[model samples]
Target: MQDRFLADVLANRHNRAILERWDDLALPDAWLVAGCLFQTVWNLQSGRPPEADIKDYDLFYFDAGDLSEAGERAVQARVDALLGDLGVCIEASNQARVHLWYESYFGHPYAPLHSSRHGIERFLVPSTCVGVRPGEVCAPYGLALLYDGVLGMNPLVPHRDLFERKAASYRARWPWLRMAADAATPHPAA
Candidate 1:
């Protein structure tokens, strides 16, 4: 099932374009992650347009060698220049520096991460926890939840309030989506 979804995502012109540009940039441990990857699949599952209601394209990379805010901004500027024509917001964040400002920004204590994938693992929802690199999709939380159309929580760092709020937003857009019982609890298979 994941393979099928991966093929579909790879076939998408928007995704392919983004992936190509991301590859061209060649950022260290870079990935086209989050909504832009999984939401396309959700739209497919619900028979909606592939790019419908996607908020942004998240590009994450780990550059521990230069964990300064200016360093991340420089990379972000480069990304903006590369993907500015896409007509969608492209958010680039350095995983190495997330812990420095995460608490101030989100009111939570985010532990220092080792790599880009470590940051992916802390996503609020299981379905949104997927990332795409040059040739593969990485889902540390497993793809079964996404394959079964179940919205599960990351037991490692469950943020129930944010999950419910985001679920409401998603439900409003994709009415077919079902919410889990609680933030810390994984939903039953669909």
Candidate 2:
């Protein structure tokens, strides 16, 4: 199932192009993660267009040495230049630096992480934890939730409020998605 999901992702023209550009950049432990991955699968499962409603492509890397905003900005600029022509939003973040600003940005405490995979493990929802780089796909929390059509909380460090809000938005866009009771708190779609 993982192989099939990955194959479907690779078959997406936009995903393929983004992964190619990401590989060319050669960012340390880089992976095209988040919405662009799982959302594509969701679209497939729901019989929607492959790129339907996908908001952005997330590019995550681990660069603990330089966690400053300026350093990330420079990388973001490079990524923008590389993928801007693709006509989609490409969001790049240094996972090693997320803890530095996560609390201020999301109003929640996020522990410092050791690697990119550690960052993936902390995603608000289990199904969104998948990522793909040049040669491999990584799903630290496994793909069962995604394949089973279940939306589960991250047992490692669940963020109920944020998960509820995000899940509401996802549900609004894809009504067929099911939210686990733990993450099913009602919220307006953003």
Candidate 3:
């Protein structure tokens, strides 16, 4: 499943381009996460272009050595300098600093992350959680639910409001995606 998912993700030209330059990113424990990868697969499944409707590419890295907002900005600047010609939004987040602002932004306290994968594991939905770079495609919770199009709340980050919002947004875009029995019930279609 990992191989299949990875191949499907790379089928998107934008994703391919980013992974091709993984080494150039040169950040500690860095991985491209969330929407860009899983949504590519979703698009392919829906017979749409692989890169269609992808909002942004997310890049996460753990840098305990520098937790300041300025340090995170510097990393993002480097990413922009390197991949700006891709003509897409690429968000590079330093996982080490996420905890500092998570509470204010999300109305919940988030513990410090130990690695990029640790941050990836806390997505609102377990199935939607994935991270990739070069030879590595890390889906710590596996890909069964994702491939099955089932949105389930992640035990790792059990925030009902956040989960409902995220699931609703995804379902709004891809109506074929169904809620898992354990997932928060999605909002009625508007």
Clashing pairs in 3: none
Every model: Cα RMSD to truth: 3.2, 5.0, 5.0
Residue pairs with colliding backbones in model 1 are none
lDDT of 3 by residue, 82-179 (tens): 99999999999999889899999999789888888888888888888799888888887788778889898877677889989999999998899988
Candidate 1 CA-lDDT value? 0.79
Worst 10 residues of 2 by lDDT: 181-190
lDDT of 1 by residue, 62-96 (tens): 99999899999999899889888988888899999
Report how far off residue 70 is in candidate 1 (Å): 1.0
Cα lDDT of model 2 overall? Answer: 0.81
For model 2 the TM-score comes to 0.91
Task: Show how many residue pairs clash in every candidate, following the order shown.
Answer: 0, 0, 0
Better of 1 and 2 by TM-score: 2
- What local distance difference test score does each model get? 0.79, 0.81, 0.88
Candidate 3 differs from the real structure by a C-alpha RMSD in angstroms, to one decimal, of 5.0
Which residues of candidate 1, in runs, are more than 4 Å off? 181-190
User: Looking at candidate 3, what is the lDDT of residue 111?
Assistant: 88
Root-mean-square deviation of Cα positions for candidate 2 versus the true structure, in angstroms? 5.0
